[model samples]
Target: MKHIIERAQIYQALKAGIKKTGVVLPGDVKRALHQAIEKETGPAGKVLRFIAENLESAERENMPMCQDTGMVVAFVEMGDKVEIKDAFIDDIIHDAIADAYEEGYFRKSVVEDPLNGRKNTGNNLPAVIHHELKKGSDLKISLMLKGFGSENCSRLAMFKPTAGRDEVIESIAKIVVEAGGSPCPPTILGIGIGGTMDYAAKLSKKALIRELDDSHPDPYYAQLEDDILKRVNELGIGGGGLGGDITTLAVKVEKFPTHIAGLPVAVTVNCWADRKTIVELKGKDN
Candidate 1:
């Protein structure tokens, strides 16, 4: 039986996602921040305290956690057995974003053109959407609001297949070191390895949505993540780059198959806000 989803459900989901993610830091993120605060000292500790206070205020006041509401990126998983009733998914999502941004008074950061004109899109329409068809009868939507401050600091590199693990580690660590506090320290690092250039980049962005508390299922990758995280924190960049122990809140890595001769890696940095929201919808009982 085909599961039918209503247009209203999609609209509500998009709007709620924006509101939820924009204002409140995720539970895991908050916990990490608190842990950082306890472990930090000196100016970095003070800076972290201020960040925590600001986040609490934002959540209490129901205001955006950051002034730059960011570019919308939606990942949608649609079940093959489901059909929407009288609604186009993309259209509905964009319209909901327009309404939510307007109603919630969120910043419209998307530009109509990237290079030349640089005109603002005004309503933050045309979200970058990624869709996948799955086997079930439910739909899952994950939204990420990416601020350019961190996005601009992202890096991608293509290594020869024969490059050793040390090469990969040093390469990515160098990116974090050079970035300093620019991408906003206490940032979450998303590392993507073993895909084509573009896919590596995509995987890096996708990795950002994963919770900080979750560990990679594979022990090798888990150890790699831990090693990289330790190296980054040891850089002594500290909170907000003033210098200290907690430069990165967490490091998440995702990998994919690549050409035998090419190993591509991408690093995406996400600031302390790390806004991610998810919604799942199921068909009504027949």
Candidate 2:
């Protein structure tokens, strides 16, 4: 089998994934949209009707589901037996972002420097990459195109170990309520618990990749997911914040055992346009 880590191959995978997934709206989003449509009681429903039509049209056309193509986040899992032909992992991901944005005609939403000399990188290169090595030969790549609208709404809190479940639940609920209409409600909620502030936040963001319809395996946490989902809809932040139930399609929490004195929680919200895809590469013969 030809060892392939050429930038072009990476580009092809990124673009294909973007086209196929076309911004994944979770189950809670569908529920929220329907609730808002039912309760809107005015032309606001018409606005939502239009939004729905637009999403469908954009998908059918293979165009970007949203103009803000978002920040490219690549999750790379390296197989044990594969050999890269001629590229660094970072370079592959960055070039893929650049290629997809340019050739795919998606917006470049990245800034070179956040503080000084702000400049557009033009093609959205230098993706934010998280890498892990695994025990196989074929490489795997997963992606999430994170837009600032939702990303800006991420929150982290460090609580006393005694913070308890209620406190954690409230923090997430408040974030959704305050975020109202922004981040394009109804949204997916990713909760990271038990780590330090930063690790908690990372876990929350990555958890968005979980399929929207699946429940957590742990029953206790699975119940927490359902409880959070139910309460979030009660916030009345319905689809696009037009007012109704269905504020969330899913609530996912990933946790790690932490020090006895701390309870850290982080929430990352993904708008209705929750775009992600994963690809597992196979050799020519396979």
Candidate 3:
């Protein structure tokens, strides 16, 4: 017996998911913003109030929350027992992205070429896709619309194994300071430790999707998150980078095993919007 899924169904789901993500702030992020507004004063508080209002309006109107619709980053977990009928997985994703950007009026920000004759792709095609294989007959997809304001502020550092935890903390603090008002403060920090350079970077991006209300299961990392969040807020970046406490809403860390000689740390910055949505499809054996 085979558990099968249709390509059209997958495409429609992807299309809807991307569109929704662009317009809606995740519950965790929205709640954090409301809390920040209550805790803030002066201009920072005003900014948070405006941001909250914007988010509400965007969802109500079914419109993009931001001018920069951002590049789509997707993480797909596929089950070995189920197959996508009559289409390649990635092609399906690209098609869905293109249609979503067009029909949803999302800004097409991707470039066809990295250098020289750089031209707009016209549609947000060729999403950055990450795939993983998992047990059971289920397809889980998560999408992130990552705007350049935060992406540009992200940093990666490769440290010697002896650099120690203090060094790691210092590095993260340095990033927040340097980023200043640029990444649109009251941002979330996604810190990825260990692993190779690229893997570390990927982990950092993946960390952004973690729920803001949750802490690292490991007590060590959970403590680190608290410490880092405190240090970052001390920067006085505040909401919209106008200056105050609450530069960072949360700090999330994800780590992978790496070689004995290296400790690679990557930080992915996400603006207060933190747009993301996830979809899951289950298949039953016939």
Candidate 4:
């Protein structure tokens, strides 16, 4: 049975999701912050507490948690058996983002042109959207509000295929240390390994959307995540980059097949805020 979704349904769901993402921190992230607070002491612990309070205030007051509400990045998983009515998916997403930003009073951060114009798009249109087809009939949208502080710290490197595991861990740790407090300490890292350059980058960002508590299914990668995370925290970047025990909350890694001669790695960093939300829409038939 084919399930149908109308344009209005998509728009409404996305709009509400965006607004909520801008204001509310994810539960996993909140839990991590609390845990970090307990693990840290002195100034570092104080900083984590302050961050927690700010999040609470934002949620209670229904205001954006950060002034930089961030650019929208949506990952859409559409079912193969689903049918859409009345609009292109891209147009629906753009309309929904525009309305959400405007009505929610979220900051407009997108520029119309990169070089010549540098003009604000005003409504944050043209969100970064990645689409995939799945077997089910439901539409699942994962939205991330990517603030520039951390986004600016993103890094990619093409390592030789011969590079060993220790080298890869060292390379990633160096990036985080060099990033210092700029991406905001207690950061979350999304790592993409293998694949071509661009796809690796995309995978890194995609990894960021995963829940912090979720471990990689593969034991090898899960251990790698733990090792990288341990190395980062050892740097003592701490909360707000003010020097503490917890430099990063978690590390998420995603991998894809790549050419035999190349080993591409990309890292996408998200600040402690880690603003994101998931919206699942079932078809009318369901």
Candidate 5:
């Protein structure tokens, strides 16, 4: 078992990572955005120029990339042989979130209930955490600070086995066109393509934690991602919703084997300020 600091440290790391969102653009994403900006012939280029400049300033000053710090979602891959020492992983994670919010001076956005109670959680406790056991010795934790702007617009569809690739394409295209710019255009789409309905949704959300520029390991899936990216950008919902040639930066899809009768699909979107990071824990400290 590893004896790394408590989940508090993990929480602090997440908070720190989230704060960098729009500010510290991933190198590849930044490059792509720059290229798109340069090649544009209209106002989208201007908007992108301003965005790039804003990003530079945000990163240099170490400020929250976007005013909305976002709700924390964690994806933990634990090793079968690795164990967390002296703490229930869940409690450690919660306490870490509490401590991170306190130390980072972040906005307290989560509340007690969705409707009736409407009270603040005060410390963003009980973060959305998903755990999995894989064949490794080190624990890998990935965090994505998801904002409702884009998340609110995502959708899931369960189709009969007859629903083909064309239908999936249509659904995604309609979603992007309907979203317009609310989720902040030039979005990265996460698509979950199989499994049960709920599990598909989970996979969709999990996809958002991946690096924007990556593809699923399978080549056929990678082509699907490329196709989706092409179709989404064709929507013309340019940066911040402006009319432009590039509306989506990428499409990431993850899939799972499902019941023979079901074809489940889910889409989760990340705004321009995609914030995420991966960290690993050594023996005795996960």
Candidate 6:
């Protein structure tokens, strides 16, 4: 039996999710920040504490955590047995974002054009959407609000198949070190390994939405994450890049099989704000 989803349902879910994400930091992220405070000292520790206080104030006042409300990236998983009745998914998403940004008083950061015109889109439309079809009667929307500070620090490297784990680690660490305080220290790193160049980049962005406490299902990758996290922190970038023991809060990696001759790695840097949320909508059938 096909289960139908109403346009209004999706719009409400997306709008509420966006508003909530903008104001509230995820539990895992809040915990991570608190934990870092215990491990770091000096100016870095002070900065992390200040950040924690800021989060509390934002939630208390119902204001955005960061001024850069960010460009929206939505990953939609639609079950084969589910169907939308009244409107296109993209249209609903755009409407939801427009309403959410305006209603929530989140900053409108998106522009209409990249180079020539550079006109403000005003409502933060045209979110980057990725869709997947699965075999259930529900839709899952995972949204990430990516700010330009960390987004600008993103890097991709196409390495030779001969590149070993150390080489990959060095490359990623170098990128972060070079980034210094620019991407905002104590950031979370979402790493994509293998696959083609573009797919790797997408995977990196997807990895950012994972909870900081979540471990990779694969043991090998989980160890890799630990190793990378250790190496990054050792670089001494610290909180707010003032220099300390905790440069990054966590490292999450996602891997896909790739061509025999190439190993593509992409790193998506997310600042401490790391705004993301997932909304699941079930159709009217069990």
lDDT of each: 0.89, 0.75, 0.89, 0.91, 0.77, 0.93
Q: What lDDT tens digits, residue by residue, belong to model 1 across residues 56-122?
A: 8998998888898989888899998888987889998899889888888899999888899999989
Model 2 segments more than 4 A misplaced: 1-11, 22-48, 283-286
Per-residue lDDT tens digits for candidate 4, residues 150-191, read 999999999999999999999988998889989877899999
In Å, residue 157's CA in model 3 sits off its true spot by: 0.3
Clashes of each: 1, 2, 0, 0, 8, 0
Which residue pairs in candidate 3 collide? none
Better-scoring candidate (lDDT), 2 or 5: 5
Among the numbered candidates, top TM-score falls to: 6
Candidate 6 lDDT at 11 equals 94
Per-residue CA lDDT of model 3 for 31-150, tens digit only, reads: 888888888864688888888889989989999999999999989999888777778988988998999999999999999888978799899777899999988789988889999999
Winner on lDDT between 1 and 6 is 6
Instruction: Give a tens-digit lDDT track for model 5, residues 7-109.
Output: 5555556555554543476776787677778766656777788878878887788666677767778888887767655667667666655666566566678
Q: What CA root-mean-square deviation does each model show from the true structure?
A: 1.1, 3.2, 1.2, 1.3, 2.5, 1.1
TM-score of each: 0.97, 0.87, 0.97, 0.97, 0.91, 0.98
Task: List candidate 4 segments past 4 Å from native.
Answer: none
Clashing pairs in 6: none
Clashing pairs in 4: none
RMSD of 6: 1.1
Give the Cα-based TM-score of candidate 2 against the true structure: 0.87
**Which of the numbered candidates is closest to the native, going by highest lDDT?**
6
lDDT of 6 by residue, 1-286 (tens): 9898899889999999999999999999989999999989657998898999999999999999999889999999999999888689989999999999999999999888899789998998879999999999989999999999989999999999999999999999999998899987789999999899999999999999899999999999999999999999998889989999999999999999999999999999989988999989999863
Worst 10 residues of 5 by lDDT: 1-10
Model 6, residue 192: C-alpha shift (Å): 0.7
